[model samples]
Target: MSDSIDSPIIIDLPYEEGGKKYDEDIFARALQTETHQKTGQVESSNVTEYHLRILLHYPAVYVIHAEESHSQRSEPEYCVYVGETNDISQRTYEHLYNDPQNRDDWRLFNNHGNMSQYVITHPYFNKSLTLDIENQLMLYMSSVDHVSLPVNKRVNPQRDYYTHDRFKRIFSDIWLDLHRKNPSLFPAEGIILDSALFKASPFHKLSDEQLEAENIILSEIFAALHLESPDQIATDKTNPADSHLILVQGAAGTGKTVLLSHLFYRLLTQTLPEEDAPLIHSPASAWKSDDKHQDGDHASQRNLIPKEDISAYILVNHDEQIHVYNQIATKLGLQNRSGTVVLKPTEFLNRHSRKNDRHRALLNEPIDKADVLLVDEAHLLLTQGNRAYSGKSQLFDLLNRAKVVVAVFDPNQILQSSQRLSPKIQKLLSPADDSAANPSNNGNDDEPSRIQLDDYNNAKPLTVDVSHIRLQQQFRIDASPEVIAWLDAFTDEGIIGELPADCHEHAWHADDSVDTRSKPYDIRVFDSPVDLFDAIKKKAEIKADGCDGKGLSRLLATYDWEYTSKHKNANDPSGHWNVELHQDGTGTWRMGLGGGDGTDNTSHDRCFCQPWNYQLTDPHSHRKGLNKDQAWAEKPYTINEVGSTYTIQGFDLNYAGVIIGPSVQYQDGKVMFHPENSKNKNATNSRKDLGDFAEENLKDELNVLLKRGVHGLYLFAVNPQLQQRLMDVYEASKND
Candidate 1:
């Protein structure tokens, strides 16, 4: 409680070689006062006294950073460590001298020869607030393009505290002030907030459900990995095929990916006491946690004697999503002397399994097993043989190469025949049977149930264990329960019921809300594709006031148009495949190719037309835009192109203009889905094993397309009946 609260303080100090011993000089300067006192008299004022006491006793957060990439021909990569402590001098001393002896990150910061640290403080600093601040710093640094590695790995997001309401403004203020000091190190806050990596960062504040799921995952991992000490157990001799699976079930935008990312970071932060190697058995004598290594204590000194590094891998199937994961893994230093840590399932399988397994597993040689494998978008994992993979099941193949496999599965997101979950597997994943034979899977995720698999080669009786945890909240849509329910009904069950009264209400901007400045979540239906795209661009334009604009809007559609990958269309010589709609409200369905110049007849006004994904020339061909690695949707020029489930599946947009193609239509009393209308073979094709899944596949594609918008979803249906129905619903809701 100073007389007036001042802004956060930021000062960068050099860690010089052969300099004076470290001291608390930053706070010492803050404590300096121009008090005119007699030689023996001591000054006393409540304001000064209060400031002095808090400065001496209160908590503060700090960041230490040094260049990691030292190549003369390349750019500098800063390795950053974020932390909070009550005693700055003691903590810095511990990190500088003692911590370097244990952790490699600390050693680099200590011996890099050129190092600088930023010590931050504020009048409102407390244990909780400082810890949250430190976590937020980690979240941002993990996504910053220039920061190559994050030294801090622990998750310390706190619940509501005394000053919880001020956290966002305070953190942004601190970051902005710091940005003024160093632009490269601390870029614009808005730019960072708009990144995919930032949205999926591990340091974010988890919902109660996410936090609960994280705790459950961690406990399961500990229980599985802590079965015995490293030396006592025969891990090398044990079979890797007996690995367990933790299946997290949730629909799209339900925060499944965030929970998975948190688990991935947390699992890597753990350590098993393995002088020889890691073990799955519990031995109390040697087991210890390396979670708090950033607490500035050498492992040995603090009895955290972890000799073996925990083997962990995070895999994904989607290209865009895997890109995001690899960036995060690289920035968090989530790797070792071995190759990459984040990889595709095929890469993981190919690397760990014997090459003969594409034909057969190498005889006698053991599988190169990892301690844990975390799979995101597991629904996309192929179940049958393909060109790159010859396995029976990717999930089973993953289990064969690791001690544990944790998968995030959403049966609804399965968009291909190859990835289709068979009836048997679906039954195993989300058990609908509550019989005595499968009582454990009675809709309870507290304990995992067992799944029997016909052994890899039918050589032995092998069964894999499976667990199911459900996440029900929709995190992507910034709307109320009624709004979300309407979306779910419209997409999931295909029931175009009356829109909710508050379907357009902004949940964050209610009269009784904390942040009432955000714009409402827009839900509209447009008659013209041109109008829909125009509205999306209108929303995409940067707003002057509080619309929470990230300046990204995209036009998406159902898989109805023919789009060949990388093939230049001969009809339209622009070298781009276009999704065309003529001025008469007719689309590719009527014209027999959306882009045939509308040559059939009538006037070709080109009402609405845009290139499909990967067809546009490089918008950042001159140089890397923003000097950072970006996903397909993050690029500035992608706005001109239409995205599909492949490029934009695991991303978010400010607003989405989705054109419901001929695949989805409405009739007298119900909605109809036409599989034959869609050109996406992945959705419309049939499998030799599982006959016809076209209906569900197309539905899932529409589901993903409609849910991409965070603040809004505008629609234009190619089918007239569907279009009229949607418009009628909008008009009815408006007049009411």
Candidate 2:
């Protein structure tokens, strides 16, 4: 067991007294005498003033010293003072009885009674000295009380009256005894005795077990501490001579959020010179106090600005993820009174609004007035263009003001239609700009220049780059390793070694009905827009009976299937598929509707009309509108009929039935999935080629969709050729 101090212990003493002079020799001899009485030591002459004070203040020790000194008038004065006391009253009584003899020796005394009075006055001349001595005495008495046992046990006391050496011994004993009684109570095993005892003890160093535990904790702290801002990183890397930018890529479940939070903590806690400290605005600064000025005016007054600035560990994401990040920040104790801000696309537009002159005015102000910027999901950034001015995205504008910028993005998940890096951002991340020299430019001035903007105009700034570290090892899947492996082998086909055998054996299983020709693992696809409507209605009915436990009529049908189908089909086929599939996959389908004409239009024209009826046309307006009447002339569409791709991306059913509508695939080879036909014709082609890209793209999407089940896949093809191609791919990949 090693001896180290386990917990903090404080000792307070009275202030020191001055004025009286003493003979060093006599003081030394008196200390030796006290030491001999307490610890049988003859080496008291070697003791320091500090040790002498401790001995004198010890509860059971005392020191008496006599001294003589010349006054300013050249008169010799003699004085004597007692430096310790066991009983105050008894000591004073003794001093009174001996005062007469001491006074008779003084020539200044007029008479014996006067001499005694003068002698006593010499000792108590300074009331401050007396107070100090009293305070010291009280301090030692308190120490005795602290370590003392109960009053009843004082008589049979565990130890004798306190001595300097005895106090040291007992303190060590008590600390060790506590450890022996409850070892686990200490943070680490073993105990740290008092410093004095630690020096004396042979076992003062850490044990092997203790050292190992200390190393573990130290490692965790070090890892947590290394996270810093780009500026700080630059300073650390000794690269302050050049400006640089860094990008961090990480996937979900990685410690990106935790790392960012740690960085913020470090930035806030960093010690900066008084003048150089970063100016930060706190939530309190934005709030007004109720207190009025002395003039009794009604004007609002700002609260006192705290000397310490309150900064945040901000987590930036789309509006949908804001609630989740806010909850995480709150859990980590980083949330402040100002609350979290979710920077939506519209908010960005509002900040740089063309129509709002006031907003434009605000944009012209100095940018450094804000704190550092941290962007998560950086890949979602997009550029803007207008007839008046070529514009950069809101994210680029924010980067100009921040001294340190930290961004996290996964290149694989860039979902925006225009998913190309802006020139400024590209320069920041990868400085070598080769786009200008490309032969395809043909000296055309109409083409946008790919020049990097020197936005900050700073002499030098720091940049730090970090790669994504795997955190998948920590996720424990509660399924058979074999089953999980089989699913991963198919869905993540090219990405090998992802699923272990343990994951596949415990996976859940489900089978499909043979009549539907749908394998248990196959995703159910609707035959046509009308068939999709019917299938959804049937599912809703089943859900109402089995899960919702309510009559089908009770469930509200917010959107008319026919109207939604027509409106969705109105878009270019690729755009339509992208909106439906991505929205449904990411569980953000609601955002797609919340943003556009989906919210506007007359009551009848709105896709989601009121009431629970899923009919394609209003019964009351059956004969009112000619076009609407013709559309719904055949039969009423019910909730059981309509389905959207968004509702079933990651899900799998026992049987899958797909309907390839003519809008997507035509016999004349007018394929909507062709890369050349896409909105951005020049975009890089994925594994799927031009003409049949839609069907091929659906292969992977459907793979992700179907493998969610345990047994098999059931796929239906409305277009025989497209269906045959999909089946061929699936069958070929199965053996591989």
What TM-score would every model get versus the actual structure? 0.85, 0.33
lDDT (CA) for every model shown?
0.70, 0.29
**Superposed Cα deviation of residue 382, candidate 1 (Å):** 0.7
Write down the worst ten-residue block by lDDT for model 2. Answer: 148-157
Off by over 4 Å in 1: 1-6, 17-56, 67-76, 101-103, 226-241, 272-309, 336-339, 357-366, 432-447, 455-461, 503-518, 543-550, 585-606, 624-629
Q: Tell me how many clashing residue pairs each candidate has.
A: 6, 36
lDDT of 2 at 35: 43
Over the stretch 1-736, how does candidate 2's per-residue lDDT look in tens digits?
0111221111111111132333344344544554465457564233435444432332321212122342332322222122324332233333434333444422222121211110011111122332223222222221110111010000000112223222222333333333343232211111111011111111122223222222222222222223334545655744321111224443332333334433343333322222222222221122221211111121224322231342323444344334334433332223432244324333433443334453442332333222344555566554433232234443444443333345555443343334345444555454233342221222111222232444432312223322121222111112343534544553344222222223132222222211212112222332222333344344334321110021121111111122333244454332232211112222221212232423432222222212112223444453422212111101234232322222322122222223332222223322233333223221223322112233333323333333322232233333344444444545554555
**Best-matching candidate per lDDT:** 1
Model 2 spans with C-alpha error above 4 angstroms: 1-310, 313-340, 345-358, 361-374, 384-395, 403-406, 422-503, 507-672, 675-720, 727-736
Evaluated against the true structure, the overall lDDT of model 2 is 0.29
Candidate 1 lDDT at 153 equals 57
- lDDT score, candidate 1, position 698: 86
